[model samples]
Target: MIEYHSLREASPEQTIAWMEVLAENLRPSDLDEIAATSDMDPLLSLTTSVMLSDMAWVITSNDIPVAVFGCAPAGPAGSGLVWMMGTPLMDERRTAISIARSTVPYLRQMHQRYACLWNHIDARNEKSMKWLRWSGFRLLEAVPDYGREGRLFFIFARYDPDV
Candidate 1:
């Protein structure tokens, strides 16, 4: 079963530990390399603090983190950005799909004013792209040179005008 909850539920040390795992899963400790080529905000620790305190959502299965996602609110009248998604607990596609579906309702609950949600989806993450599609996000545009390092990225959005 997947659970969505606050960061306070876990210790700070545990959160930091999650970051270590996330770093390894995503880059092999090579964020410096990615950062060098792009504008890596890397505010995850701070972001997670904000989410746990108030802005993001953390997803776990069997008490282990499967994913975490948060975003800056959409200005006063607009929808917010889908800031980030942390490590996947396993390469099991169904698990990722489950975690993502469980997460969307939380997002809608968190931001009711937003008509559209957007993300600067990294071009290199094809695996993530597949899972994101399963979760309801749609590819909107390819914004070339969007990152600080001049790399291209996809702008994805998911919205319900009725909501």
Candidate 2:
């Protein structure tokens, strides 16, 4: 069974287990992006991201974590910077489709108090860029020299002026 749990609710043992899986199975694009932006190892990166997020969730399938995702407040009030990282299990066809469909609702919940939700995606991650567009985020511009390694990245955002 698939379940969603608040990141806060994860036990230390569970966190370690998830970290191990993610360390071994994180997508290449995710690994590249993290390496470009920080010196922290995958485990530390995952832990730090979850800690900094204002609202984050863990998606588990039969008790194994498949993904962790959330958003943190960004500069300028009512704006949020969102992110997601997942293990290879998330790429299973059915799981992928379900996760894609669920993203909008999760973003809606996360953006309830924010006017805009935005983030940067590695330019090489075409799958994620397509998914973001499908979820209604507009791709703004590409940064040719983004992050520590100067890899290309594209800024994407979803705006709700009424919020």
TM-score for each of the candidates = 0.71, 0.91
Model 1, 79-162: lDDT tens per residue? 766654555453466676676666667667645756677766667777767766876789989988765676667888888677
Off by over 4 Å in 1: 8-21, 24-54, 88-90
The sequence of per-residue lDDT tens digits that candidate 2 reaches over residues 63-143 is 877888889898689999888888777778888788888777788887797889998889888777877888889999988
Query: How many backbone overlaps does candidate 1 show?
Result: 3
Lowest-lDDT window of 10 residues in candidate 1? 27-36
Best by lDDT: 2
Model 1 Cα displacement at 105 (Å)?
Answer: 1.7
